[model samples]
Target: MTRRNRSGSIGFIVDDLNPMLRGWFNYFKHAYRTEYREIDGFIRRRLRAILLRHNKRKGLGITLDAHCQWTNAYFAELGLFTMHEARVLACRPR
Candidate 1:
């Protein structure tokens, strides 16, 4: 996904990512909590990088702004599926 088209809109990127994230999470639902957290962070960081590159911005101010603004909930709002959330749901008693 690192090579994902930076020209695409964030919504388009999220739409492309959700299915892959869901499938991978389903397969590794039983993995350790820390592992899920780690992977989740990695994915979010990569997405942030994509966002930063898409915006064509540089310097710490923009980077910090992006990190602060484009948070987990923001991504969730954009329909980005999170592995940590999926794990919690999978482990929940129904």
Candidate 2:
């Protein structure tokens, strides 16, 4: 997803990758009995990662602002924060 960028809407990228992602999920589900929710969450993280990668090399504040709604979970996934820290962040008002 390094090929994607923040220069335009994400709809086009999703549209382009939908078939490949579906195929991957199908293979995992059949070969490993993966849970739908797990695969779904994984895909969400992947998409988020792509966005973060694209948003990198910019101001830290801008990067964070680009995904404020994704903060705690995202940072936790990156090991930038512990789960407890993320939970506390989730509990705080914006």
TM-score, every prediction: 0.82, 0.40
Model 2 C-alpha lDDT per residue in residues 1-60, reported as the tens digit of each score: 424353444445556556665565445543544255455455555556556666563443
The regions of model 2 sitting more than 4 angstroms off are 1-9, 24-34, 57-94
The candidate that achieves the highest lDDT relative to the unseen native structure: 1
Which lDDT values do the candidates have, in the order given? 0.76, 0.48
Please list the residue runs of candidate 1 whose C-alpha ends up more than 4 Å from where it truly belongs after superposition: 59-62
lDDT of 2 at 79: 35
Name the top TM-score candidate: 1
Q: Where's the lowest-lDDT run of ten residues in candidate 2? A: 78-87
In the range 1-94, model 1's lDDT, one tens digit per residue, is 7453366888888798889888888787766566888888777777887777787766443366777978888887888788888777877899
